[model samples]
Target chain A: MKLLPWDYGVRNLLRAPGRTALGAGGVALVTALLVTAAAFVRGMNGSLAETGGLRNVILLGAGSEDSVERSEVKAGVAGIVAASVPGIEERLGVPYVSPEINVALVVNVDGQERQASFRGVTDAAYLVHPQVRIVEGRAPRAGELLVGRFAAARLDVPDERLAVGRSVDIDGRPWTIAGRFEAPGTVLDAEIWCDAQELRVATRRETLSGIVLTLADDAQTDDLDLFTKQRLDLELVALPERGYYARLHDFLAPVRAMVWTTALLVAGAALLGGIDTMHASFAARIRELATLRALGFANGAIALSLVQEALLTAALGALVGAACVLPLDGLAVRVSMGAFGLRVDGTALALGLGAACGVGLLGSLPAAWRCLRMELVAALRAD
Target chain B: MSALVECRGLTRVYHKGDQEIRPLDELDLDVDEGTFTALMGPSGSGKTTLLNLVAGIDRATSGTLRVEGVELGALSNTELARWRAHTIGYVFQLYHLVPVLTAYENVELPLLLRDDTRRERHRKVAAALELVGLADRHDHFPRQLSGGQEQRVALARAIVTDPRIIVADEPTGDLDAAAADAILDLLGALRRELGKTLLMVTHDPRAAAHADRVIHLEKGRIVAAAAATS
Candidate 1:
């Protein structure tokens, strides 16, 4: 059957500017909320997923495999593993083994105390985790500290406050900010790093938290496992770096679920409001709809016209919502684990727009059915 | 001549919470081709209901309604709508012009149902508006027009499709005396000049006087039939 002219639906939206604005604005807010929730989930998952090196393994105390911060290996374990493991990668005769200490410390920044992730590392960390790149200044020396790009966000401080030459008090002693590093899309971007020997001396730690070792291309993880098993007296466990991060992601599944549930509930309420607005709009046009039917237009044609009107309104809303969200791309968001940037990427945008259109299509159905189901003669008689 | 519209034992029933109301009960009538007929009756007399059934906008609960040799009762709703597009032009008392559409666009609505080209549609719409003496006001919306002018636009919409018959329900019911007279004169001109069959329902004798024949109804049955004095 023939449909109504496209301009018919377009012009109807202009009949009541206030109502149209209300409907469009509701859809816009829902779209923006959905985009933000998507960005949060994506950013969090991405940060965790990108942190682990595929060819690396972690050697930590067997009982503390869940959290490296709680894991303790002997301070000499890095050298022992590099010598015992046959497949440890070597560059210019130096083994790719990093003895690291992962700790959470309360630090005073600009007179404000904040809990921050602190990693004590040797130079081998750059060899194993290639994603890390120092963008400015140099690696931390003797009593200095290296800050990650997102460290300021995690510490709730301004970027200028963490620049090189600034000092933060750790263990009641001030450590100079010597450099800045970036590990994009990784949780490490929100941690502070310092020389392991100095950190051990300052914190009075007797053991290293863990040892991270990269394997050569021909090497298998089975080799590391075999070495760990043979050296059981060391009380060490060999775990793939990727598997550790994956477990961490699974541990945070409930947070993601709560995020989605909350977003869905709010979006659902907005959708209902949109439906009510459309119902009111269409109900006021019952007589006109019936007149079209009486003039030989089919119910399907009229319904299509109504849907077209809804889609146009929703598209306008989606455009506005997307514009509002574009500037938020890569915006830093702080969580308990660390800080990750809100990723308003293409997938997030697609989901937001898809939901807006879905609202438009679904919101119009009840109203269209109610208006079109009326008896033509009675509808013509309606005011 | 054979009747263009024939209704035999036509009945329509409505139910409201266990109460059955019969608006038209087994009414029989015939409206000849190329003639203007007016149905006159009181408020629940089924005059408008019969007009609606003839226009194919409403259905009879039982019995037969034939327009141009097609049994309207036997057709499906979709089929009836298609048939209505080709066979009938309905004019409502309120004019019922789509508020968003200009007079030209309103008149062009029914023709869009057919496969007419844009030029062809424009040609017919322009002629219809010109015939109704609103050619100069083609771009004016319904709100921009006076009551008589709006009804004329509705009339223009009714005839734009060039259907075989036009059914008008109280076409002058909402108009002032002078406007009502002008609409009646135009209705008369449609039948006289175009040879188009007209079926109209009106409570006003002055409106009925424009018809070639007037049928009086009470309690769903035709009480009297007479030639118009005019």
Candidate 2:
């Protein structure tokens, strides 16, 4: 009671256990929605950003900077870039360059067709994209296919259907699934990877989609510029991988906006509901607050006590939201392009807690101010 | 003895849609230090209004009201609040002990405004609760106590600040005869033992018997003053 100790506010919250639970529940639900939406954007955009390493570069056909899937170069362009580009990173004497063929095709799953991306890669693809790791079985060889961990979800197929020893038909040709791979935070996790030659023969398209390369730490883009200039007949465009993904991220702005707008509206609705509830709760305590005021407590002190109570409730709500959201870390979420894992990292957790606190402060102060502004005698006389 | 409270032409007015209602009109009064005095009157006779003004919980619309030589009308709202914390102890008819707080916490409410350390607050709250004969029930909340016990707790809170003047508004109005006698006896003991000034407003004549002096009011004017036979 002295100085309205913090526990006084806390005990007041417990005085009406039902109301506290309802208020805290409302806050928790809103916070969960907020964290879920943010984790979704974080998972989607994070995949692209993580995949686009700063030192990596992509060589595509002329006039195809936007779509790596649609970009096409000659099948032999990988060797040409390895030889022409002087700073191509070397790993164990092998150049870190991968000539990949990306095919977006419809795959039949349980008699229904679902669109999926298939990438044609070789052993050097692993060196160029280190995020990709074979978590089960081994890498795909000729006549074999490797499915990403989240490929089943992206393809709308049963998880066990894409396991090792299963077969998937691509363009009327049955390909054996030899392994399962995981690319933790990349769009590639929603695709299948197979031998480039086998995919070329199966699709009967000999052209490669693009060539990805890792530049040496001390390397510069000037050499790649010169290479593109010298290979004018090849009709190639060299671009930094990060810049390419950055442009793609910009293209996905509308989708991110949609997600954010929906999330905020939900949170706003919850906030208004919470404010109304808190207003009623504090209104019922008008005489109590007036009594404190009569006992020499300043209006500011009583208001502080009210805010402290609200904040304590919100903190409890945040704790509940965190308990529900932290498990979402590493949970796979499928997107149109590929799949990425949801992550509730420290930043995401902090953001959720901050949003809950903001709701608490915004929800309680106005109600308290209105209640305290009443004349002390009138308030004390109120039932 | 010198007067602890002085009111010269003290008045309070309220307006209800252009209708002016004067609760206390040019009221002139004085309460000496260490004396027990009671103000009695019918409903709307300005007894509670005068008590509120003296307690510094309400402002006077016009005129001078002083407590311990500080003119209440001259002080700002904030300064008046500080003055009330340091100078006045008020007990309410409903025993307005915060339902959520224990007896000890209610008693310590006034002490929180002061710069007393935790140890000092504990000592004062213990002594005050002991003085009210509820020392063993310090941990009990208001709802846990009977009507008389709750009033005693409220009294403890009022006096815990060790203020110079104690003001009660119908302190024994809600109690039974035995409990009323106990409360009146305690109020009488406070004046005799601590040399404290007591000013109380009451409608019950038996409740006023413990006071040394009783003032009657009618329509915001002092109609008569008399000595208590008890």
Candidate 3:
């Protein structure tokens, strides 16, 4: 009556020295793989969700909702739209609309084709989106550029990484890493920032890559879309910050689903492997179980004990696997998003932990079921 | 007065494809409190089948069985299980001691079904082990023990719950004469010292000689009943 299902199962699993260890290791390996896959999916989707909201609108090449990089809007368009807009949100007595430009440059950093997105922004762009903060040195001067903390890591920029006055050449021109900033886990954390006009000229295809605007106190997000749709001279798209990320998440939804599905499928195999180990262990101890039954244990008690042992082993394996994936949290790595670099974040860690629990429970089921389903008389003599 | 074990007209049948066979036919048996009885027969003579039915481990094809006043034939699987745990303790020919468990753990397994504290369970396991003369070997794994020690551990496990009846099937089948005698002597002591009713199935005459009475079964019916003279 005092014995728990988990405790009994664990004891039974330990009955075989070699087989129990093998089952646990199998569960751990599969769990780790599951966590890692979930991490990647969460990392990518999270990075995408962090960028492009109503604060920013890409006036793409008419049909391209996919990127602002290929889009163009004249500097004159920003001024006209700002003045004509009746309900744009204002901050510090200035309209919170800023024009921006972007380019993905393949920099030869220590002999590798490292892909980095270099963004050019007007001073007011900081007001439109307020999350950015300079952590080291100062903001880029008109003549210099700034690199994010993660970008600094990827380029092996040293202890002087992203330090003021440190320089990295892009296309034979030295762009000084004038300052360092941290916007942890956002896609912006992997991009280089510089003066809009300079980048506009250097990468020159720009009328303006996109415009970002804040909502007026009285104006809701829906008004922006309605206004854009009603305009005859221009075609536009507008979405709220939450809505923008949701779209990005939807685009990458398959990756997330696959993370779970792959884990489940692989865990199915791992569960079978665990069952094999458990079966072998129980097979050898059948007589012992029968003897226990003979000693007055109810059949329910005996079956429960075996199931408990299997679950405990699997839960331990999951804990081990979660520990294995913990170190990958926020590691400096990049993936492509309209040629921009994206960062892994806290969301990835959560997904990894979730995957660990899933592997533990799902993988433990078959073995536990087999244990519980056994006939007491047969199981007792299994050895 | 309630008999610790009882069976009446117990008929157990076996079918092979379409061929029906009878293992136990119209058998009746009863063992009162503190009595030790040995049931003997050749293979296929339903000695083991009778033991199984009386122990509530198998269904009698047709008959009435009552162990401790609870009709075995009237209980469902779940109830039968409860009955088995509280009323009967079993010893198999193979000893069947779980290899992973220490002697104490093996003995404590039965108490898992009882409402007992860890202290109570430990006390019971210790006492059972002591009773079997293996208190010092309480932590030894089954593999670490000799055949006789293992059987004794099995015996300790059977009695730990203090069940009304101890049902043993070929309890000494694998032992030599000396080991077999030691086991029978233990059974004799169990009956005299603890007043635990004992029902054993065996082929060994020496083992049977330790019982207070002997019943001969042939083709599933009791053929003769003889008082123990040894």
Candidate 4:
């Protein structure tokens, strides 16, 4: 008699439970890997962000985002900008700006010698950017400097090695060991910080390398962009803190997107494989469908039943895929952003689940349609 | 006579690439209600074509054909399918039973198109199976049954929804003599006991002996008609 529409399709799917399981599993696995790639990208972007609201606008004298550290501004220019620009953020009525000299220095740590960019700042540096926390020892006197936590560990600089009275020779200048600070595993944690005036005299660098700025939270917003753009000093560059990270993402996005895109492409291939699997599943049972049609099932009802089977398979795959990617939750990966380890986060899981569901659903359409369009007599004849 | 199945100048052609082969050449035929008839012809003489046209499985190339007073040739393919489901029952030479289903489920298939309740369908299917002497074998699959039992189950499938006309394309063609006897007897019994109109195509002399009348065809033309069996 005229039975329920989807009953046959569901039963048919259940008949070969092993095949369904295999297809769903394949889809879930590919989806999880793609999500992991997305998560890695998000973690990298999060690492570069400056949460302390400092204006190390790396006023690049030239070059693109990837080459920001290489750009150098004359130390004298920072003094000129401070005098010329009004309303820079301040603390205790001091203008919230620092004329800093920066350079990358190589040092041996745990047998690996690597470049560590050192930003020589004035005592006013802490006033401009407050996220830096001294984790051990006291602030350095004029001839000394502080190491970021990650920088200290990477260089294998021990407490004995970093005692406030000791010193290490760099470019023939004896740099005394001072304090060590941590900046929550951010880009700042990979660099060394010191007093800029002393560093300038010691390094024989006459011009400041960069100007760090901090604007008051109550400062004007509408004219900031216009004012920054109008500066006419040797091609001055001004960028917002958020705008800076956003640019960082844009520069880093291609590599990240390529990784995820490869995953997505692989997921697409897996989905097509799933569709073929389901189609093969349907094709194997032509006689079964003919028998259903002969029993008086409407063509649409028969088709709908097959589609239901496919969608169920896809949903199962998505759930499995999501769970598979969950363990990548807060994984720490060491990548150089000047020199620290960045940890990847949860966005990869979301992307993995989305790809799993999308591919699973889309792949099912053709298989379901092929199953439903079976002609009654021809199907019966196949018997 | 006014008939349940009428073929007036029915002609059908089969095309093989560029060649047209006429299978049924403007033949006329009639089958009365509650009568069992047998059609005998050589392989290419078109006995199967006549049954297909009269049952709405195919349309005649030209000429009027009607089943249960409905003109089948004029209806579209889609409509013809609906009419066939409601008006005709077909039995194949191979006893085409869906391998996945039990005998009871196979018989109940045609009723799936009807508006019967679950209980009503079960009742009808049970009655049909009982009529075929297979009430005890309802749960058995086709592969588990003998040739006679399989064809009987096919008969149950054909008549399950109570279609007015039953067409059998070589119903006993593959059976042993004893099994063939049982099937022919069942078809004869359906005619006498249930008042079913059965048009069967067969080459078996014993199967034709159970028919109320037999028509012989040669090269797509009716040569002789006999009523000795009825």
- Highest lDDT model number: 1
What TM-score would each prediction reach against the true structure? 0.97, 0.98, 0.86, 0.70
Tens-digit lDDT track for model 4 on B117-225?
8899999999989988999999998879998899999999999888888999999999998888888888888888889999999998778888889999877789888
Q: By the lDDT metric, which is better: model 1 or model 3?
A: 1
Segments in model 1 whose C-alpha atoms lie over 4 Å from true places? none
Listed in order, the DockQ scores are 0.83, 0.64, 0.43, 0.23
**Cα lDDT for residue A174, candidate 1:** 93
The residue-by-residue lDDT of candidate 1 on A147-178, one tens digit each, is 99999999999999999999999878999999
Task: Give me the displacement of residue A10 in model 2, in angstroms.
Answer: 1.3
Sorting all predicted structures by DockQ, with the top scorer first, yields: 1, 2, 3, 4
Each candidate's clash count: 0, 0, 20, 6
RMSD of 4: 6.5
Global lDDT of model 1: 0.92
- In model 4, the runs with Cα more than 4 Å from the true position are A1-4, A14-67, A71-109, A112-218, A222-236, A260-281, A287-300, A316-323, A332-379, B101-108, B126-154, B172-189, B228-230
By lDDT rank, best first, the candidates go: 1, 2, 4, 3
Global Cα RMSD, each model: 1.6, 1.5, 3.8, 6.5
- A-chain TM-score, model 4: 0.71
Give the alpha carbon lDDT tens digit for every residue of A122-182 in model 4.
8667766677888877677787778775665445455356455566666655676678887
Tens-digit lDDT string for candidate 3 (A83-146): 7676777766688878778778766655555667788888777777676788877777766887
- Looking at model 1, the pairs that clash are none
Give chain A TM for each model in order: 0.97, 0.97, 0.83, 0.71
lDDT of 3 at A150: 70
